[model samples]
Target chain A: MSINEIQDSIIEDFSMYEDWADKYEFIIELGKELPAMNELYKIEENLIKGCQSRVWLHAHEEEGVLKFQADSDAIITKGIIGLLIKVFSGHTAQEIANTDIYFLKEIGLQEHLSPTRANGLVSMVKQIKNYAIAFNLKS
Target chain B: MGAITTGLNVQAIREDFPILKTLVHNKPLVYFDNAASTQKPKIVLDTEYHYYSSQYANIHRGVHYLSQIGTELYEKTRHIVKDFIGANSEREIIFTKGTTNSINLLAYSWSSAFLKPGDEILITGMEHHSNIVPWQLACQRHGATLKVVPLQEDGSINIDEVKNMISEKTRLFSFTYVSNALGTINPVKEMTAIAHQAGAHVLIDAAQAIQHIAINVQELNCDFLAFSGHKIYGPTGTGILYGKEALLDAMPPFEGGGDMIKDVKFEQTSFNELPFKFEAGTPNIAGTIALGTAIEYVEKIGLDNIFAYEEELLKYGTEQLQQINGLTIYGNSIHKSSVLSFLLDGAHPYDVGVILDHLGIAIRTGHHCTQPIMDYFCIPGTCRASIAFYNTKEEIDLLVTGIQRASKMLL
Candidate 1:
């Protein structure tokens, strides 16, 4: 699927919820379904540092498409990361680098998140972009 | 549970705080983050609005009608703050941005002049980062040593350790009057005496204590006391650093700018006297006036009344929260204030805070800017419920319910 299509699907999925409670419940459920990262990839080098909740994101290029796995100690953060992963993973590094991810704000995720969570979101996006840049350099 | 005489019409008092009536997530807002910052009363908001609308001007600069009125109101706050903290004179109170700024000012100004190589600055383990980092920087700059007064198991500083630590080389002893993270009310009065006996100066970070307790710099006999306005129902970016007049007069000015100077030549600049020399800028004129009203608002409520009322809330909160299975409270200091720092078993503090936030129960989570204390306690962070006088038993009950809900959901 295209980036825009995936994001639109995510937005549509979130908009199905009537209230914040339902939205959060859905997010938590998504977090539970996120594929677990290998424990070896959970080292400090792979960890995103700025998040209030500890999150580890690992990326590697598979046949010119970027694949990612992540986990978080906090369920909400895990859910948020899961959402990010669903959008950005399985895409070309170039597409991931250039794409503007507005689905968080489109789905009111930014407005719902606390300041710290918002910071965590920003950090997560930056790490993804950094990974894309690294892959671009290697290629 | 035993109750103390507060002599406050708390329901009427709540009416004065417009934010207290606010609803969040379909629930009445239960704000228990007073140590982070207190909600402003309507009187403070009105005072600021009135000042900006009519009485706005650059203070201590212009001779115009508005400037004079602004100067009077702004200077009046100095006198008000002096009386609020029971300082000997208004000259001792130098307004700064906040507690962090105040501490930084002291670190730069006082330490530069007084500290030397091998001299020690003693702070405690439970100190907020604001209290710790400034001294660390100062020590680094001056080639001085920094010492820490270790905490007892109950999170209170061991006074004997402090006495043992303060020696001929101990130049400054700085500590918090109350731990914002732990809520342990340190024995400042006794500690001040000990520091003074060792011929060392003392600085008390009263950011957590000023709103809950009566502060008399003269009575505590501390050389310096720092507190922020926002923590006590005033505007942010405004605070006071109360220094002994002699000490302030001797130290070099922290920053030099207009209003802090008597006259400036191309080469030589003669500095202004106490308070103004340290203040150094166009000052937060509106914020200062608003802080005056905030002090008056709290004074009218009376610190004794606030103390009694908040202590009751603390006690009630402690008892109720203790009933939760696998919940552990930090800082069992016998003389604590209105802070309750706790953790639920098998649950992260961020998860608990998120659950509480959804329930419209505001609390502070994470390290509370005192990472060393978290390290000492062998925890990453805690969910801290810090109360103000406006909080009620009902709110405490909601917090208990919220915690239970969070525990059930997360664990």
Candidate 2:
């Protein structure tokens, strides 16, 4: 599926929930189902230090496609990372760099990406984009 | 239900703060972040509005009628703050931006006037960054050494350590009256006495204590005390740095500006007298006047009554939170204020904070600018629910429910 298509499906799935609690429960489930990153990858270099939580993001390229793995001590941030990986992981670096992600606002979780929120989700997205740009330059 | 408990009409008090009626995400707002800042009462808001609308002018330098009124109201706040903290005289109260500004002013002025090479400035491990950073900068500027009194397992400072640390070289012993991260209320009087015996001047960071505890600088015999106005339901950009007349007289001016000078010749300048000497530049006139109104409002209710009611709320909150399984509370000192810092077994504080935010509960997460406390505890941070007198038992019950729901969702 395309990045926009996945974001649309996720937004549609979120629209079914009428309450904030229900939406959060869905996010919690996503967080729990996310594949755990390797312990070796969770090093100081991959760490994104935020005021409220810690996040680790690792990226690599498979053929021409960019793959990403990330985790956060915060479950909400982790679930949001899961959503980001779903949208950006399978795409080529060039395609990932050009894609404009707006699904967070539609799902009422845009606050998590605000710089003031300081949960590392903003940096996480920025790191993904930077990774994509670096890989694009190499290619 | 409107109820009166512990001689404080908390229901009416809650009504005075209009924000308490606000709804967050379709639920009633439950504000438990009093330690960060308190919600303003209607009177404080109205006073600020009224000042801006009716009586607004630059103070002290104006001979006009409006300026006179503004000056009177602004200086009235200085007197009120002097009385509020039980300082010796109104001249002892020097208005700064806030607690941080007050501390920085003291650190710069006092260290320049007193500190020598190899002199020591003592602080604690549990101090807010405001209290710690300023002294560090002072020590750096003056070639002085900074010392810290470590925290015990229960988050309280050891008196023996304080005794051992203070020596003839200890120039200033500064510490917080209450820990903002952990709610440990230190023995300020005893500590002040200990520092005095070593001929070290004591500066109390009452930013966390001024609202919850009754303070008397003369009785405590501390040379300097600092507190922010906003923390005590007053306006931001308004605070007091109460210093003994002799000490304030001995120190140099912090900032060289318009109002701080007596006469600026081409080659030389004479400084102004106490209070105005330290208060450089144009001050926050409207905010200062409104701060007086806030102090009057608190005085009308009485700090003793507010303290009593809040203590009950703290006890109730501690008891209720203690019942939750897999939860651990920090700062188990016998003397505590209305702050509860805790962590769940397997959930991060940020995760729990987000879940609680959805439930219309406002809590503080993270190290609360006291990273040393977090390092000592070997945790990233804890979710803190600090209370005010306006908060009720019902609100606490809602908080407990929200925390339990968060634990169920996150853990």
Candidate 3:
């Protein structure tokens, strides 16, 4: 789904819930359903350091589309990875590079991440975007 | 969940802590972050006030009435801590800034006197950086070698690996008695014995283990034991270092200042006795007195009962968290302390932590100051909810309810 569609669904779902707990559980469950990409991406170049769980990513521009694959030992981290790919995957390299992930704020999901986890997610997303920039520069 | 005698009234015991009654966003504080530091009871708080209010004076120096009272309270705390840990002598218990400073002092002074070229100092992979880094500095400064005992896949240190790591050149072996991140309770008594057989001094960092566990330094035969008072419901900025009196006397003073010197002359200087030799300058007098009351508060509640209560809470917490479709607990041990680390299947730990906070459940989020453990697991961090004797199962239920609710929003 588009980020706008995801935002609308979350707002509608959140409106249906009375308290923070219900809304939180819904987001976490939604994270669980986020699918890992079908292809493997376990190369050395795309690994994240300082995480307690293993997370690996690979992104490339195929015919100007920003294609990405990722995996992690932690299930939730993988779901978070899937969330990132959702925002960037299938987009043009330049578009992927320019998109402001601050849209995470619009969906109201950014505040819940702890400083380190939030920082790690940002690094992961930044790395993908950097790869897009480098690919654009290379082409 | 084993058969153990119950009914010490933990709920009644928890009532003594006023902070538990405190409100955060109109919700009663459900504190699960005891591993970071525990909430203080009235007695511990009031003890500090009592010192500053009625009897504020410099200890071991002042000669008047208020000074005598301050000295009495401070020295009395020394004896209380000695008995609390079943140490052989009050002289053996030297108050320091807390566990980190204590370890640094031990490594610095002891290695300066004894360590030499090719000597090996062994420690575990599961140690807090405080434990690991001190040895690294000591070994580097003193021409000693640093070696680490490997961690098992379950996060416990393999004793056989420790034995294998030991050599004739081994001068010291230090390990954390309870892992700050993993919550696995190590067999420090047995490990100390093994290190002794290898002809090495063993230092046990009890920073995370001492509050709920009963520690008898004499029985363990550990050469040194360190713990921070803050972890045990006392004020911060105070720590304990229990060294064998003979060893403490033989080692040089860590820092020289007033009260640490017997008599200083322009020509020559002499150091004070065992503890005073190590404790430099005016100490954390208020912190020391407050720590005594914290120990007293724990004694009143009972350590065995506290241990039993926390184990039940951990079991319940583990079970409830596992009931969620894909939440994973890091340390799943039969013999463990209070803290439990885990991650929900579809969210960042920070994200989960933030959601928990929005619901008014507090937990420690991130690497927990043990970056090595996080690196070992290959994740950035996990959310840790460390229970204390005063923490209730009802609080654990609230934690579960919060996490289960947060799970919906993250996934």
Q: Pick the candidate with the highest lDDT.
A: 2
Better of 1 and 3 by DockQ: 1
Clashing residue pairs, backbone N/CA/C < 3 A, model 2 = none
Q: What is the TM-score of each candidate against the true structure?
A: 0.95, 0.98, 0.79
DockQ (CA atoms), all models:
0.50, 0.87, 0.21
Query: How would the candidate models be sorted by lDDT, starting from the highest?
Result: 2, 1, 3
Q: What TM-score does chain B alone reach in each candidate, compared with the true chain B?
A: 0.98, 0.98, 0.97
Candidate 1 structure quality by residue, lDDT tens digits, B1-411: 454456778889899999988888788899999899999999999999999998898988687999999999999999899999999998899999999999999999999789999999999999999999989999999999999999888989888898899999999999999999889999899999999999999999999999999988888999999999999999999999999999999999999888898889999999998878987878898998999999999999899889988888899999999999999999999999999999999777877888899899999888889989988988878999999998888888889988998776665
Using TM-score, give the best candidate's number: 2
DockQ, 0 to 1 scale, candidate 1: 0.50
Off by over 4 Å in 1: A112-119, B1-5
**CAPRI grade of model 2:** high
Better candidate number, 2 or 3, judged by TM-score: 2
Residue range B1-411, candidate 2, lDDT tens digits: 334368998878888999999999788999999999988999999998998899888889799988999999999998888888888888899999999999999999999899999999999989999999999998999899999999999989999999999999999999999999999999999999999999999999999898898888999999999999899998899988999999999999999999999999989999999989998899988888888888889899998998999998999999989998889999999999989999989999998998888888999999999999999999999999999998988988998888889888887
**TM-score for chain A, candidates 1 onward in order:** 0.91, 0.98, 0.71
Point to the candidate with the largest DockQ. Answer: 2
Specify the poorest-scoring 10-residue window by lDDT in model 2 chain B: B1-10
* Model 2 lDDT per residue over A23-97, tens place: 888898899989999999999999999888899999999977999999998888899989999999989888889
Error of 2 at B326 (Å): 0.9
> What does the lDDT read for residue B282 in candidate 1?
87
